[model samples]
Target chain A: MRYFTTTVDLKDSELDHSIYVQCLQLRREVFISQMGWNLYQHMGCEFDQYDTPASVHVVALQNNAVLGCMRLLRTDNDLGNATYMILDAHLGRIPNLPSGIMDEQIQSQDTWEASRLAISSRVPTSERNAVLVDLLRTGMEYVATRGGTSLLGMMNPVFLRVFRRAGLRAYKFGRIADQRDGRLCVMKLDLEPGAAMVAA
Target chain B: MKHPIQEKFNKYGFVILAPGQVPSDAITTFSDEWKEVYFRNEFHKIDPVFEFAVRSTRNSNCTLLSEAQMTNELFEEARMFEADSNFVSVSHYGGNTMVFGGVNPELDPRATASIQHACQATHRIELLKNLDLLTDTQIDLMEMAEEGFLDKEIASEFGISLSAIAQRKQAICKAVGTDCFKSTLRLYTLQKWGGLVGEYT
Candidate 1:
């Protein structure tokens, strides 16, 4: 059996409650224990303010088992996606906040921030790239359908190389020290009229 | 809007390199010192900015990447050019596609506008190709899936065989490379109208 991707609305009530719990559990396994990001853990899952009604969760599944997942949030929405960009401000060091990209992103409502892309380390290496590519393409398709033109994310050097090599068009911008790792930078991928950057 | 390099920054530049071809455009405001360092370090191996420029075909509007978005190495090297922002875009005309890149000294509109209009207006024809397009039957199946319809419900509503619908759903899932039904529906919804959407004017 092959894998497929789907979106889970945090606000949807008719869905199986276990799937939501499974998402969180997978996130805890991949992001918390593996990636070591300092996210708030609830019931063994990781999440933060951006996990509101506005958040869009994309999951990769194999035989109904969660293989990987990622989240999307509109930058201009009240979901706190863009608001979280100002880490320095949150630390009372507003003086060091890099506001240049924010000033431009705020002026356009077509931008969304993608974060917390988690892939199970247990997934065989053969199936790993497919999961990541699927999640990314699904997210891009989602943004384009919403009349939005851009997708933003904080990517580490590893992801940066992967994206460029994947034939995805990403524009790297400001960098910040990762809370645990060394550093990561912001990237913007446009989903406008021409997405021809797909690898040939 | 009042950044010092606004005027020079808006003068965006572009060059067309086909797939698998490396960019050799020499027309740029930055000096050779940093460019050499950038290329020597194989920055292109991880340069998302350059990748973005070459991937998507855009209109004459300028794209802005703020300081917060810059990568550490890129930012450190860009500081040598005294650049604070990047104003870049790509476009297609006739059979030729080109990616444009330049500086935006600051966050000014006029500055970006200048860059957007800087492609020398060459190959002025709009591109005729479509990026990703889906079929009507696919769209219907996707919409039904999107509405939270069960496999049986979709079969009943469409007067189709349940196994056939199941097979279709399976195909859709494989095409999207995910096991999630919602993601398949989401992909279908996005591409139902054909993967191309106009600017949100």
Candidate 2:
């Protein structure tokens, strides 16, 4: 069972386009079908306005099968009324999430917001943690290599424990809100190039 | 474990090394200067300020080290690390004694209010930790539900009737005194951190 990770952009070649589609299908399966999050779906793929050309997709694959995936957007990006997921949620642009999710607005090239993190249920229970670690490690390294210093997202508090155990410096920055899907909190992970963390 | 309590104390020029299940688990913090020295030298043993903190009960221990107490080697060396002679500490005395404190030179009205806030936050974190209002099965049920398991899926996982799963979830919400099951799960996570206190996270 070989494991690897890859990053895709919409402007890339056709192969990257196919991988991105698989990522969206994986998101649909985990978020909309399983978790019941009211997200936009087209042809059995979950996505939102944040899925722009500027967005980068990090995918974890095992033996050519998509096991986990997440999306990254630089906080400085803007796409005609949308900034990033968390900031959009804070500004009341996203209806499902409660407004005022973050304390202040953030627009920095050195900061990126990660969202739509999903690990496939098809992966056996024993291997789920490994897949998640791979996906997160790749995502953090990708951000750090691109001069990103901080990664922000609204995530499950359970993942907080995962971050702590993995030696990633993460903390809940804002309030934890009870959403219909689960209890989510704004978590920030400070990324440093080649930092000490659990190996993928 | 890295709890938000440490971050709260850090905002006020205080440092809590790690708020564990016992009194000795704490280490001072002032933007990371005194932490190494405090832990390496075991300053808690000779520091009279820490002694006052250990003796405090249900109240904030605000004390200024006397000339005699300051003469101790801990205070003398700690001065180089920005440790002042005055300090304030708060505690939550339950099954375990957890202390959080920092040096504060100005005991003004805002500082007083901050002390009260620390006392309340400490009490609440501990209270939620020791609540134990839900059963083991109920706790598992909430966790599974939070993992995005549907009611029927949870019932199948637990090998119980769907109705029983619904009833247990309702019971969990009632036990945690919340109307929503997700809110109950939030409380459960807070309580779960108690067991995770000592472990590195």
Q: Given candidate 2, what's the lDDT at residue B96?
A: 29
Q: Report the C-alpha displacement of residue B74, candidate 2, in angstroms.
A: 71
Error of 1 at A91 (Å): 8.7
Once fitted onto the true fold, the runs of candidate 2 whose alpha carbons sit more than 4 angstroms away are: A193-200, B1-201
State model 2's lDDT.
0.64
On DockQ, the candidate that comes out on top is 2
Listed models, DockQ each: 0.01, 0.03
> Candidate 2 docking: what grade?
incorrect
**Cα deviation of A66 in candidate 2 (Å)?**
0.7
Please give, for residues A1-200, the per-residue lDDT of candidate 1 as tens digits: 28888778777877666666677787776556654556589877667666777888888877777777778877676533335443323333333333343324342467777776766655543345557768888888877766678787764433444455467777775544332222345677776465433321
Best lDDT among the predictions, by candidate number: 2
What's the C-alpha lDDT at position B19 in model 2? 29
